[model samples]
Target: MRESFYRYLMTKRDPNGIDEISHFANAAFFDQAFPKHSDDYHEISHYLELNATYLPSMSVFDEAWQGYLEEVI
Candidate 1:
């Protein structure tokens, strides 16, 4: 799924030529990638923390999460 998403971002087939995968444009894709289920908020948080810890030298997860929250509002 991530690979497909990267391809989507790398491709320039969209009308606007923006390939970052906006939330609305890729709702189904994100829903599949990060499903809303289970009873483990802390577990998920820990998992994300682990990923953020090593995923990038400069983390943008916080900014991205803020943007996602703003979108929800």
Candidate 2:
């Protein structure tokens, strides 16, 4: 859920606005961001599922992971 929310913000909102999103995007924030009757989460989940086969590189659980460099002693 957290990852999905991050993706949503990065895609729809500003990519650098994650910190703000974390502060404002709770249950109430979700209710406000999406329409009251719209099933946005469900739709996003469904979109992932639907495109899972088409894009193996980008699946529902496939995150664009980056590893931090470790400092040598």
lDDT of each: 0.35, 0.33
lDDT of 2 by residue, 1-73 (tens): 1233433433333434454323222322343333323224555445445643433333222232121011111
Model 1, span 1-73: residue lDDT tens: 1222223322322445343334223432333443233224354345446543333422333443344444433
Q: State every prediction's TM-score relative to the real structure.
A: 0.33, 0.23
RMSD of each: 9.4, 11.6
Cand. 1 Cα-lDDT: 0.35
Q: Which candidate is the best by lDDT?
A: 1
Query: Candidate 1 at 63: error in angstroms?
Result: 0.5
Task: Report lDDT (Cα) of residue 55, candidate 2.
Answer: 30
Clashing pairs in 1: none
Candidate 2 Cα misplacement greater than 4 A, ranges: 1-8, 11-39, 53-73
Clashing pairs in 2: none
Look at candidate 1 and tell me the lDDT of residue 39: 26
Candidate 1 lDDT trough over 10 residues, lowest sum: 1-10
